[model samples]
Target: MFDIRLRIPSWHRLHSFLGLGASLFFAFMFLTGTLLVFAPELDWLRYSEVRASPQGSAKLSLGTIYDAAARARPDWDIVTLVRSEGAWFADQVTGVRPEGRDAFLWVNPYTGQVNGETSSFTIHAALLRLHEALFIPGRLGKLVVTVFAIPLTATVIAGLFLYRRFWTGFFRWPRFSSRSRAWLSDLHRLIAVWSLVFFVPLVVTSLWYMVETVGLNAPATPANRTVARDQLLPPDFNGARLDAASAIAAATLPGLEVRKVILPRRPAQPIVFQGDHTAVLVRPRANAVYFHPESLEVLGAHRGEDLSLHQRIAEAADPIHFGTWGGLPTRILWGLFGVGLTALAVIGIIIHAKRVGIMQQKIAGASARSGFARVWRGMGPWGLGGWLSVGLVVTGLALLTRNFLGA
Candidate 1:
């Protein structure tokens, strides 16, 4: 059933429907996403050290960062600190706050200094929200984006069909001296040809990402974890001791360093510690060691990297979406993609507008020749419906992509 929808130029029809409503918002998303493509460079410009990963270089133990955080908020549980592009930022969770305060503080890669507290993550964050759902609260954002994606995909496909004469139309520049409409079509086609090269890959990747992130195949948790998988690191549930800490270190955590020990505030939970493998870049990289809460005794360890294949792929969507793997080169590519796409959208409409004017002129001339009776008869069922269907879908697709995919 779904495959049947793909047979027609459905994406094109969708573009027309959503484009009119969301043109402005999508333009904003495109511009911001484009600029953000160089965010690592931008962040480097803002903060100097680019100190490259928080694994081995430790003066800032998880304990110390936790301590610093404990001092600052005193009442929040650490909700996993993000280690990305060599910078450490905390996403500490607080109890009373309605919206968790995004307490972004820099950690000393070597010194363990938790520096700077700021409430202004908005500069980098606002556009992110608008990019996703225009900041709509819930399922509305999801539904709108999904609907948009179909058309966006369609527009690109239809665009290729609509402009089938690639070579002749590809490089032709608009004559400024010509009528405004003539110029608009020329300009539109020119921009579309150029931008489409970069825009298509980016748009398709983004489409895959949108569907992937909201998908169901996440990593299996501890309950579903297997012995073959967990052997690399023992499970740490505070359930039983992995012998004692030193003994467990000898048996379970061989060849790796115990970077930081997360002391437990509760007896029932385990004292969790992570492993450091400076060598393997793609290794699950962090492993959990469980210990008795009171004795600080090692219980068992779990290898975070050893997950089922589908789970690993599912986990990759966020990094892929953020372009974290290929690093700066990826960002630059995506950044250019954003710019090219915005140009396409703007130029797409201009071309559409120009063609409509030409069609109108032709229709009027045909009316004169055929008389109103014949013209009306032609328009009666098929002619009007064709224009309406094509226009509606094309415009709809644009808006939906902007609202959902672009977001």
Candidate 2:
């Protein structure tokens, strides 16, 4: 009789254990990250009752929108007016109905009407907090997330090494069988192989954020300081005297799509129109044109293309991590693929637990048959050595990536 039971390797068990241990937390991350893909749309749904329908007519000026928002919430401090697929204004955390929460006001761009106001306590905002910091307080929460990135990357790498058969098999689907463990194994392997390409960018970029966050090393961004003018505007001015439309018209760059119009808060501060161009695929806010609030004179212009390589890569990380670089299609794909990571974690746990139970049974039976005190060990010194080797490899790879890519 030929026995064809699949024999799991020692390193394979180690990797599976690593993933299984972190399965629950990683699953939370995956689910929350998926929701964050459409965060803006989901957040807007929280205020759908008062949301204004899009009008076909000409939109109101940014100045008008700011005034309407200010009038709607007299106590609120209007900070920025954003013109996206929709028009909205954000105010500093004014603690209105929801005490200690930031507020966002949606405006009817055509008529300068304050259409809707939403607070920071919405489900979307909570999910974002969870995704970024696990709802933990302050920098400590960020550190918790940053610390986990390395171990998570190690698990992914170990999984890749264990599945070497994938390349040789040309990614063949494991044959379907009535065996439950075999079926799950096949499915797991299939998803793991397909997901490896995306896993690299996901983990590497994540590690980059973690490293930067802990202040081990961080990417440098070009300094931007608001240039103050000696000539002051009228002290009694109630709002921005120059409108956003005129400022944008005077300062818009070639081939850039206007995304947001930021009205200056102080007299010396400039009205900035920020947007994206096809050249910079990373951040949608890659291009900027600044205009003096009173004079409407061009103060400065900045482009993402002008940034240094390291700065550009750092900026690109956000869009790549969020899968926003390629628009809605890419975001959907990222969300879908993110589910596979969760599945790998879950299935790895199940498989490891089942294997542990089987091993215990085998050890018990062997002890009964041999009557030997220590004869029934599941794995000997060889397995311990294999685990040590795997650990060393993971550590080396992570450090190499951090030093080279980050530096």
Candidate 3:
């Protein structure tokens, strides 16, 4: 039977209580995701060095950028070969490794512009795992991430309610004198109110992923090659050819910097790929692709603003969380929300510690009377039942895996 007398208060509920013990990790991820909204613009600022030229139109051709990258940094892998656009300058990384670093760079395909180098920070990836998925590894990681998503959703709901409960707490912040209780309430209420705006998108967007990937709809997205990469080469080059690759390589971005390149798959197929930094895909100013890999031809192109609705919303995920989507205002909102959640996570631990301490004292002080003993026994079955359910799930999965392998 449930322990009615020992019921958990709604106000005392934590994300962990809602099965999102790891919600903080995603919270952190959600925060940084907003920053990624302007990754293209930000990349330019973070990695490139700019200078005003004679304001010319044409820069070096695409060949120049690719060659510069390969020659300037021979040891680095070419994850991408950028061709600059008008007034942008022809620039590319020229040298880099992608696995552990930021993999950031910029080039002006016009003037053969060059930028400095930087990689993803160790702290960034580590904290990212800590926030979005709790750094869980393999299949187990998926389960943990899924479980945490539950409480994270609940926390958002509860946060809204809690915010309402403490709405008035903000008005008096500037004038009120500081003390332990006053400060705590002040901190909670103020952050909660401000946090509501930014976190709403985080919850809504991440929740979409959860519903799509983990809920009843998982099968809807199973991959079947969204499109075939038509590849054609000399029969010697397998079933592929290189029609556009050579021409595209020789092409120039006119006067702008070529942010990225989207080339059709090689050997030979009926498609083409081109990339840009400013466009958002269906959302424009975001990203995606278009192609007919068979003929090695340019069928169509997708820029940031030229994406479809579903694609736009989907693309919004990174920008929504990182602050890149809405430009400065929206990005700032996300940043504030992320910082606020971090603070919320910290305060959450304190509240739980206090409650746990109180509970321990109460349990210790209880007399060894028959009535208390009887009460404790009643709660045992509930705890035991939960444990058994978990055991059954574990066993069932193991057996299923073994049987599948045997078959």
Q: Indicate which candidate wins on lDDT.
A: 2
Model 1: lDDT equals: 0.50
Judging by lDDT, tell me the better candidate of 1 and 2. Answer: 2
lDDT of 2 at 379: 22
Q: Model 1 segments beyond 4 Å from truth?
A: 1-25, 35-64, 67-78, 86-102, 165-220, 223-305, 357-407
User: Residue 107's C-alpha lDDT in candidate 3?
Assistant: 52
Cα RMSD (Å) per model?
Answer: 10.1, 9.5, 10.1
Q: Pick the candidate with the highest TM-score.
A: 2
Estimate, for each residue in 170-285, the C-alpha lDDT of model 3 and write its tens digit: 55563257544346656756776677676676667666656544543322111112244333222232111332343542242222223454332333332222444455422322
How high is the lDDT of residue 304 in model 1? 42
Tens digits of per-residue lDDT for model 2, 131-185: 7766556777677666668767887877777776666544667667646667677
lDDT rank, highest first?
2, 1, 3
- By lDDT, the better pick of 2 and 3 is 2
TM-score of each: 0.57, 0.74, 0.57
CA shift of 230, model 2, Å? 13
Q: Determine which window of 10 residues in candidate 2 has minimal summed lDDT.
A: 370-379
- Candidate 2 ranges beyond 4 A from true positions: 1-10, 49-52, 56-61, 86-101, 110-112, 168-171, 174-176, 216-252, 264-269, 365-407
| 171-264: candidate 1 lDDT, tens digit per residue | 6878889988678767766766776665565466466556654664354445312223312223342213322453465457565455444443
